[model samples]
Target: MNVKGKTILITGGASGIGLEAAKQFLEIGAKVIITGRNQAKLDVVKKSFPSITAIQSDAGKEEDAQSLFNKVNDLGGIDILYHNAGVGVPPLNLGVPNNNHLKGAIYEMEVNYFGVIRLNNLFMDMLKSRDEAAIIHTTSILSIVPSAIEATYSSSKTALAFYVQSLRKHLQIINSKLKIFELLPPLVDTDMVADRDDKKISPAQLISGLIIGLENDKYTIRIGDSKVIYLLNRLLPKVALNLINPNKYNEKLIN
Candidate 1:
């Protein structure tokens, strides 16, 4: 879809991919409203990009979603609802178990899965009312191939991916023009994975792929190496699984 002359609402837009996208969207002439849980971060982003609107909202909470809805209403409705708010896995290495780790995993589920659902439900009517609209969910490649160290994080995305697919199918049957797009980005070079030494694509690359995918009417946009990973998982499940969680094959190598 042409991003120009559109009103886009991006959750978790204060930093990382969301922040970068907000900047690009603003440059492309879209009225961008970004929501985050931290007011200070939002304020910082506002100071940096005065054109974009930044509001503090926690996607994991119903009240926050409602408040965001009201805030969007004030901006005259949104043409694009971009679900980017999510939590990364805890820093604990694999094989290390703790009660706090379990809690963190559960929290990831609430934010990564249920939070997106809540916001979607709250914004469905507003989107359906618009002449041209789209819903983009930024899932992960881990959904296709679970990360051993981030089991809950991967699982949450897997569940969300299924929901998005089902929602798309329903929309198709009803002949609704509301577009649904899922973005699978693998190890992006953002704050989420800044400390990692693994190779990662820049946010600019991700956004470029996204725009091209949308323009070509692609339903699922796999950025960078995610496309290869998705194919590997589909054609060679065991191989893909082993590749993602190399530790799973460690015992065999040692043997």
Candidate 2:
């Protein structure tokens, strides 16, 4: 997958991992377009990177997804559709049933799982038409081993991980040229996890690993502890679980 000279569209590109990916991709000569829900953030990104295109769109909304597809198609479809947009609801105790629990779970599923499917469906035909096209899905290490504190977030990522595998196989069976890539990142140091005290990797480190994966055609790119956890979960499931949920998370849950 030669990313140089390719056009890439990244969702949730205003900040965090997505923003770092945009910067790295641009450095490698890829034309980058970023979409985000916040107009102010998108405006700031555009000002900072005049060459990068920034579009204001919510990944979780059906109408916004459709509008984004139409706009991207008009601008000439992308060779790579990077699904970096994801959301995690604040941790809540599932043992105590509450209305907010269901609402939060639904929101997480919509943005983290269903939104990836929605955008992929819209861009499938366009991607297929390209000579060398790929879809990158940002799944999480929690998908390999669920987190007790972040149960819904883990479930959403797990669902997406399954979908990415199935979608890749389906594309292969159909003899399609389009490629599906899954990126599993562990405890990234981003605004989304600011309150967490867990060991974290910088967004730059994650994106650098991702770019290397893209260049080498590594369909499943696991970064940092994600690679460690994936192997540990297979060989030592209990140890993997203990590592992910430590004592602090369990204490919080009990209290």
Q: Which candidate tops lDDT?
A: 2
Candidate 1 deviant stretches above 4 angstroms: 91-97, 247-255
Query: What clash count goes with each model?
Result: 0, 0
What is the lDDT for 51 in model 1? Answer: 86
> Please, what is the TM-score per model?
0.93, 0.99
Report the poorest 10 consecutive residues by lDDT, candidate 1: 246-255
Q: Where in model 2 is the C-alpha error above 4 Å?
A: none
lDDT of 2 by residue, 165-252 (tens): 9999999999999999999999999999998899999999999999999999999999999999989999999999999989889777
Spell out the clash pairs found in candidate 2: none
User: Which tens-of-lDDT digit does each residue in 31-129 have in candidate 1?
Assistant: 999999999999999999888888899988889888889988987889999998899765554465568777877788889989988988988888988
